[model samples]
Target: MSDGPTHGAKSFRLPISGRLLVISVPYFWLLLFLLLPMLIVLEISFSEARIGIPPYQPILQFVENRYLEIKLNFGNYNYLFTDDIYVSAYFNSVKVAFFSTILCLLIGYPMAYGIARSEPGQRTVLLMMVIMPFWTSFLIRIYAWIGILKENGIFNNLLLAVGLIHQPIAILNTPAAVYIGMVYGYLPFMILPLYTNLEKLDGSLLEAAADLGARPWKTFLEVTLPLSMPGVLAGSLLVFIPACGEYVIPSLLGGPNTYMIGTQIAGEFFLNHDWPVASAVAIALLVILLLPIVWYQRLEARNRGGAG
Candidate 1:
């Protein structure tokens, strides 16, 4: 008998042409939207610029005046490393991002855990409360902080009204204000991922550990913490990467003494009209951001491999 015409298998099988079309559409869209823009940025990053001219200066003499003269220069990158200000900005960006990410994780993890462990209906309500802040415009929310943190703002005014202080304290345009803004802005990013992972945890495992003579803390340390690590990694990366490149909050809340790489790059591009240097700074920021991501991916893969 010929092994042919499996009726059940044929019914379950999708058309080959349809499957190919489904795969091709997403690949085409990715290339068009994501890959193409990245390539353009990379191309511009390598191109040289003169002092008086923009990075992509048109060359009238080339290709019957249709083609632009594209010169490659690494001077901008060289300048980034050799300059003290840029180097300091790089370190400062990393330091602030790292600390802010840590703070967010510390604050968010407990909140997420509490929400995740609550009764199902209560958990839903609690999660909604956490997420409701995002419905407002992020920029507007950050701006609202300015009124609260300014020297003569509501915080100081209330304190003075209560006779807690003799004078209004300077809070806005300081590193502390920047930290507060960053933590507030990115806390949700940390909490959501952690809550998602923690919600999936099996209560039976903890019970089993207790039955096997494990203490509550021991069970959490050995099982719960390890299982929730993926969420921790995801949340940390989400917070750290963006915080490193944060521009608007830092600009609004921080003084000149608190300049970050993002502001420096913006200054180079807009204020100085130095596209090459701006691109260089952007590329440097990208590199710095990628290091943590790459490390996280490696660690994640290793953990998965060990688990498997």
Candidate 2:
């Protein structure tokens, strides 16, 4: 019997090879697309910008009688640290993203919970309604908000018709508009994760708590809320991180006073032609954003260990 496959030797080599291939593809794609691009960006971040030349240039010039050289410089990072404008933009981004994420959570949690507790068919329809808006172009959706929030827009017109306001309000080009647009855009992200988690929660546990003389609010706080923590964290991260880097909504809906890090990076790269500075800013933003992810992972690991 061929020694019974040598008692756990690599007899099924083809199956192992197939499994390895399946696992390796995704990692290979990630390295090629994500990791390599990030490494390139990091390298560019450290390089000095050449005057009258783009940030990246071939080492050897293809044309005759033309010369090219690549140089490394850290001045971009130094400038970023010394300048106050970039620092302020970074802080503003954090603040705006934080508030927007909180607002999404406040609004989405209840909606998600209600949907999850509904009948299965109703839950599917409700969730579909939440997600259906995303089928349209995101840019167009944001632009639609512009028409609604602009001076003499639909909101002002409606308010005026009801005699709530005699004149159009300057809702456009304000932080409030920015907040509205962000919350609207990211609400689905917050709701979907929450719904997924809450749907998985065992209703019997909640019922048991109620049976044990607990009120509805107490049962929610003690049982439902803690169980939904994973979804909350996941959804918040999804919304907050992107909101921090948002440029389009702010630019279209907000005034000149509202400047985000993403907008600043765009100005640095395109308007100022300061590629090194843009790369430095990008790197800094990456670090700032990734710290929370790292911290979250650590906290999650500790929680899992304690549970185990």
Candidate 3:
């Protein structure tokens, strides 16, 4: 009896400890990489801008009588609100991300639905085509867009050869170009999640709807659309979050009028050498991005509670 109890205790502890060890690895990795970097940025956001090697005044310093002094500059955050450039950039970034997400959803949903409904062998081939773009360098892909959207580029050449227009339209360095690049780059992010969700949909429910005299479109609205909501939300988040902070696409494809938060952060850090202000802007943007995730999590939790 004593041996049995000891063996049971060892087995119980082994799995518990193993589970904790596995969980702790990722938590520790996040703490080391994500949390530590964020804390550093948060610390920098509270410091003053300076012309030193670090380009920012340290917040912690030893004072007279061996006293430690902690100086926090709220001015960095205040400057963000006071400056119209930062304010405008924030709004513009959000606007671009919002519209781009909507466009992706519109385009990707159909593609995803089609793929999900295809034969199993065709599904793999279609998915490979969708994912093949990722095998190429992201920068190279964006650069390819530059060639395609330029005034005298392939797009305009095609239009001209077809007698569609008198001259090449100005697309490069415009908001339209930005939208094109965003949609092109992030389309896969939207499609994969939607396909995953739509593929797992119950065929029986769809058939049941059809038997109930629902038209295909009506059945889709009442059955398919409702079931695909999770995919829609996931894909939107995947697109929106990265698009909001996109720098390279905007810098390459978008004009001054399309100024975004990412551009603002870079300019602050590099051009102006204002580390505090840049850090503050970054932190503020992080907070804005986190809000949506927090809301989604709460909504998910509430839904689960209701179901329970």
Candidate 4:
């Protein structure tokens, strides 16, 4: 018999070149869409604000005698610290995002747990309900809330019909409205991750805990919560990251007094026509957000190391 005797064999292996190409696709995409745009923004941040079509002075130019000249404005970064508005906006954005993350966790955990523990047929229907809002336009959904939360809107009308309150409460165009919108919009993000993690949990662990005389709540605290931490962190990040830089929700539902980094950045870029300052603020926001991501990675690494 020949060393290679099989005549009906089908090879599914990719060549080295093919593997490299597959890997490089995502790298190429990141370079094009993410890195390149960031590099442009970074370059703009180093430039000075100027009255022009582009609205900023170039950092790099060919000067007299064909010499390359570079002018970097460190004031852009300093301006963010010096300005009270920017400083306050940063703090407020972080505060809102933190609270929103907490609220989402509180609300989503139970919903996710229920979904995870549901019958297989029912799980699909429940999951569909959780994600159903996504089928509609996000803008439309936010706009719909405007009708519901307005002073004389559906909520107040119902309350008045039941004589629950003497007057209509001012909920629209307020921080309360912003929080409600944030929670409503980002709840799915929290739920999906928690459900994914919880669904994979071993039933035997719970059974063992029960056999060892642990109560339901005690078993959940000792066994379930610890195991579901990855999902918690993942969901928190998913909600917190966008909530920090949230422009639409704040702009629509939040009042003029609502100070957030998104609104501040928008003002600098559009109203003030200060591109460099806006870019600097954006870079600072990116740095702030990057810290949590780095921390999460290190935590995951530590968990893996301990497990190993």
Predictions in order: lDDT: 0.87, 0.87, 0.92, 0.91
- Clash tally for model 3: 0
Q: Where in model 4 is the C-alpha error above 4 Å?
A: 1-29, 295-308
Model 2 earns a TM-score of 0.84
Which pairs in model 3 have colliding backbones?
none
lDDT of 3 by residue, 1-308 (tens): 23467777676655787978988999999999999999999999999988889999899999986988999999999999989898999999999999999999999999999999999999999999999997778889999988999999999999999999999999999999999999999999999989988998999999999999999999999999999998899889888989999999999999877789998899988899998999999999999899877766775676466545
lDDT digits (tens) for residues 1-308 of candidate 4: 22243422422266769868998999999999999999999999989998988999999999986998999999999988988888899999999999999999999999999999999999999999988987778898988899999999999899989999989999998999999999999999999989988998999999999999999999999999999999999899889988999998999999999989998899898899999999999999999999887876776676466555
On TM-score, the stronger of 3 and 4 is 3
Model 3: CA > 4 A from native: 1-29, 295-308
> How much lDDT does candidate 4 score?
0.91
lDDT of 3: 0.92
lDDT of 1 by residue, 15-111 (tens): 8888788889999999999989876666666666666645454222366687765566677788989999999999999999999999999999999
Best by lDDT: 3
Question: Candidate order by TM-score, highest to lowest?
Answer: 3, 4, 2, 1
**TM-score on alpha carbons, each prediction:** 0.82, 0.84, 0.89, 0.88
Off by over 4 Å in 2: 1-29, 56-72, 295-308
